[model samples]
Target chain A: MATMTQSGKPADAIGLAPAAPIELDGITHNYGSRLALDKLSFRVREAEIFGLLGPNGSGKTTLFRILSTLMIPTGGAARIQGFDAGREPNRVRQRIGIVFQSRSVDVKLTAAENLKHQGHLYGLRGAHLQQRIAEVLERVGLLDRADDRVESLSGGQQRRVELAKGLIHAPSVLLLDEPSTGLDPGARRDLWQYLRTLRDQQGVTVLVTTHLMEEAEHCDRVAILSKGKLVALGSPAELKAKIGGDVVTFEAAGPEQAAQLAAEIRNRFGAAGTVLGSTVRVERDRGHRFLTEVVEAFPRRVESVSVARPSLEDVFIDCTGHRFWTEDAQPDPAGGKNKRGEY
Target chain B: MATVAAAAPQAKTASSPGIWTPAYSLWLREIVRFYRQKARVAGVIATPLLFWIVLGSGFAYSFHSSSGSGSYLAYFFPGSVVMIVLFTAIFSMMSLISDRNEGFLLSVLAAPVNRSAIVLGKVLGGATLAAIQGVIFLAFAPLVGDHPGAGAVLLSILAIVLISFELTALGFAIAWPMDSPQAFHAIVNLLLLPLWMLSGALFPADRASGWLAWLMRLNPLSYGVDALRNALFPAEHTLFPLDVNLGITAAFCVLVFAASWAIVNRRTHKPAA
Candidate 1:
C-alpha cells in the first residue's frame, strides 16, 4: 500500500524522483498594466494529477501557458524536466504535451488523420506512427470513430480526439486547460477515467486547470488561486480540514449589519466569521453551541440560518471570503470584493 | 519471464526519443495535406492556366516588334510560366494564416520538433505545390504557344522550382505577424500584382520608363522571368544575358530564403497572441 499523508489519501504509489516534472519559481506575468501572475511558484511531481483551481482571470491559463512555453514569463523562471522553459523551449516542448482550452484538432480532418499529423510533428511515421495513432485513439475510446471527420462528431468526441492528438507522441507530461468544458456529465466521468488510466498505466504526469470544485476534488493535489496569487495548496480533505468547524451560514438584511452581528458573535465565541454578500458564515467546532449565540447576538438581523458539514467549497469560501459559484458567475475585477466593499 | 519484465520499461522509455523526429513527421504531414485537398490542387492548376490563356491572348497581338527570333507566344510563354510560379507561391501564404487561426500552428509549436523544421517544412510544401502547378501549366504551353524543346522544358521546371521556393519564402516572411488571412491576402495582392507587372511578366522591362525600368531591375521577379525566358526560348531577343539572369535569380533566391528562414525562426520564438 502507498503511504498515506495527513490529508487521509495515499501519496503517489510510484514515488516519482525528486526531479520535478514542472517547476515555476517566482514566475510573474503581466498583460499590459494588469498583472496576471504574481510570483507564482509550484511543482508537479511525475505521474501525479495536479489541479489549478481558480476563478476566471485568476491567471490559471497564464500559468499554464508559461509552463507549456507558449508565453514567456516577465520575471523569474519555469522549467520542465530541468529544461529552462524560456531559454531552451524546444527542450521543454519535447518533454511535454499541451491541450489548449480551445479545440486544437483540425475539424476538417478525420480523427485518425489528426492524430497522424500530430504523430508526424513528433517525428513518428511508418509503422510506428500508425501504431501510436491507433494506440492513442484506443486510449481515448475513439478508436472506432477514427475515420470520422471531427466536425461530424459530438463535442465530447471531438475533445477525445484532441486528447488522442496530444498523446500520440507519448509525452512525459501533459497539460490540459479545461478539458471538460463542454463535456456532458457522463462524458466528463469517462474522460476522468481515461486520465486516471493514463496516469496509472503509463505514469504520465498530468496538469489540469478547472474552476469546478468537483473536478478539483479529483486531483491528487489542488492549488487554489485568487487574483493571481496562490491562496491555498493541499489535497481536498486537507483544505477542508483547515476550516475550524462546520459552516453555519445565514442571510442578513445587509452586509453592514451582517458584519456587526458577526463581530458580536465572534466576540462571544472567539471564532472567525465571514460575510459574503448578504450572508454571514461562522465557523465553530460545535455548530449547536454557536447557533444559540449567533441568534442571540442578532435576533432581528439573521433572516435564516443553516449548519452544514464543511466541504471544499466552504473551505474556498473561508479562505477567499467568497462562494465559488457566485464568484464564478460574476467576474470580480477586484478579486471577490464583498458587498461591503471589502476584498 | 524475468528478462521480459526487465526489458518492458526500457522499451517504453526508448519508444520516445527527444529530437528531430517530430519535426520531420510534421513536414511529411504538411506534404500529405497538400496532396489531399482537391480544391487546392484545382486552384493551383487553374490560376496558371488563366494567366497563360487570358493574359497570353490579350497581349499576343500587341507585339511592338518581332525583333526576337520567335513569335509572340514563344516570347511571352516563358514569362507567364514564371508568373505562374510567383502566383502559386504568394497565394499559399493564406494557408499559413489558416493554420495559425485553426490552432494547428500552436499544436505544432507545442510539439518537441525543431522550430526551424516547421518553417522549412511549410516553405518546402508550398514550393512543392507551386512546382506541381508549374508543371501542369508548362504541359499546356504547346497548345497555347510554341512548345519549348525537351531540354528547355526540363530547365524551365528547374527554374520554376527555384523561383517558387524563393517566392514562398518571401510570402512567409511577410505573413508572420499578419492578424488575419484576409489581411495577408490583401497585402499579397497589393504586392504581387505590381511586382509581376514591373518584372515584365506581361511586357518587356526595357520598354518601361526610366524610373519604372529601374524598379523593374530591382524586382526579384524580373530575374525569375528573365531566367525562365532564357531557359525556354534561348534564341529570343535577350534584354539581359542568360547567365546574368540565372545567376542573379539564383542568388536572389538564396538571399530571400535565408531572410525568410531567419524571420520565421524569430517569430516562432515570440508569443503570437
Candidate 2:
C-alpha cells in the first residue's frame, strides 16, 4: 500500500518512496550582473547531517537562502519536505527550522520567552507550548538557565539557547548557517554532539553551511562549492579517498623553480603535478615513494618534501585547481579579502 | 540521482492554527519589548511634551495670527498630539530596520505564519503604541483651554487611531525594504516631516496662498489634521464638515494599509539563512 499526503500524491501516484528531505535540482541564482549560484545540484538524505562547504564568494549562503525559501533562485528548482521551495515556501517553511549566521535571539528576552514566541509562530500555545519549550531546553542542556535573559548568558550558552529556540516547533529538518562559527573548541564539540544525538534519537535531518575544513569533518556528507559551482561532493573520507591516495608537495625557492619541479615530476614520474605558488603539488597512489624519488632526482633543487593523506582542502584543490581559502590563514572575524594571495 | 529516494517529509496535517495566534503573539512582543525599554517610554512622552511647550510658546510670541485669540499653544495643541502620534508610530516602524540588521526579523520570516499576519502584528503593535501616546498628549488639552465635550471627545479618540494606523502603515511601507536605520531616518525626515508640516498641522491650509494651500490639499495627512482639529476645537472654523474630514481620512487609512500589505506579501528582498 502507498502512503497518501494532504496535498495529494507524489507518494501514492507511484511507489517512489518518500521525497528527499531536501533536493536542489540545478539551482541557480544571480545578483544583477554577477552570478551567485551556478546550476548547483545536490540532495540531502533523511537523518543526515549535511554540510554545504565553501569559502567567501563560493555561494554556500546563496544555496542556504534557496533551501530555506528566503530567496527564490533565478533558475532551476529546489524542494524541501516534498514541496517546491519557490512555489510552496509556506509548506516548506513549516517543516524546517532555520538558525541564521547572525544572532536571532533577542537579548532582552529570557530563553523561555524566546522559545515561547517561536512556538506561537508555529501555532503552539498554552500547556502544549510550555512542555515543548521545556523539552527542547532540556535537549540543549539549557533548562536550568531558562529564566535568565539571553544577554546574561555566555556566548556559547546563548548559542545553545538559539538552538533551543529553533527546535521549539519540533521541525523535522534543521537548517543552520555556519553553526559553529563563533564557538570555542569545547562548545563546537558539544554542539555537534547534540546534533548527532538529535539525528540518532529523533531521526531529524540537519543541513549546515561552513567554510572550515575541520568543521566539514563533522558532517555526514559535504557538497563543496567554489565560485558558485559545485566543485565536489561526498563524505569527508570519500572525498579524500577520491584523491586516490596521498598528496605530495615539494617546496622550491621560487615560482619559476616550482613550475620547473612540477614539469620534472610530470616527465620523470608521469605525475601531472600542479605548481601552486612556490610548491609543486601531486596526487599519486603512493606519495611517499614519489616524494623520495622526486627529492633524489632534483637533489638540492627541492628544499623540502612532505606526503600525507588528503584533507577536504586537498579535495577542493584537486577539483578547482586552486588552494582552498581558509580563515585559519586570516584571523579577521569579518569575511575579509576575497582576492588575497594564496600560497 | 534516480536511485536516491530522498526521505520525503511526513505528510502535513491540514489543521494548521489560524493566523491570529502568531499575529497576536508578535503583537504582544512589540508591547512587551516597548514597556521593558525605560528610555523609549521616557522619550516618546517627553519629546512631544517638550515640542508642545517650546514650539507652541516660541511660535506664539513670534508668529501671531488671527484664527481666534489663537493662543498659538491652543493652535499647536492639536498639532502636538499629532506629533506625539507621529513620533511614536514612526519610532515603532524604525525598529523594523534594526530588527533586520540585528537578525531578529530573520527568525520571524522563517516561521510558518502568513505574511499578512506579520504585517498585521507589527502594524497593530505600532498603532496601539502611537494611539496611546496620542491619547496621553490629549490630557494636556485642558492646559490649552480646549477641553472637548463628550461627543467630540469620542470622535477625537477615533481620529487618533485612524491617523496612527495610517502613519504607521506609511512608515512600514517606507521602512520594509530599507536595511539601515540611518537610511530609513533620512528618507522619513525628508519625506514625512514635510508631509506633516504642510498637512495644516503647522499652518491653516485654507488661508495659505500660492502653492502651499494646493500642496496641503494634496496631502492625505492634511485631512487627518483637519479631522483632528475639528474634533478638538468644534467651535473653531473648519475647512470641511466633520463627516467629510472623517471620510477622506478613513479612506487614506485604507489606501496606506493596502499598499503596506502588498509590500510585505511580496517575497522579501532579504536573503535566506
- TM-score for each candidate, following the candidate numbering: 0.87, 0.93
Error of 2 at B114 (Å): 1.5
Q: List, residue by residue over A1-343, the lDDT tens digit for candidate 2.
A: 1234655654622335677788888888876666777998888898999998987778787777778777888888888756788877777877888887778888888899999998888888999899999999998888999999899999998888889888887788999888887799999999999999989988899998998999999999999988889988999999999999899989999999999888888889888987898998899988888888888889988998899999999999999888886322322111222111110
**What's model 1's lDDT at A102?**
67
Candidate 1 regions with alpha-carbon error over 4 angstroms: A1-17, A322-343, B1-24, B59-66, B69-76, B267-273
Per-model DockQ against the true two-chain complex: 0.33, 0.43
Pairs clashing within candidate 1: A120-B25, A120-B26, A121-B22, A122-B22, A123-B21, A123-B22
Evaluate model 1 with DockQ and give the value: 0.33
Instruction: Report the lDDT tens digits of candidate 2 across residue range B147-226.
Output: 68888888999999999999998999998877677888898789999988998887888779979899989998888888
| Residue A215 displacement in candidate 2 (angstroms) | 0.9
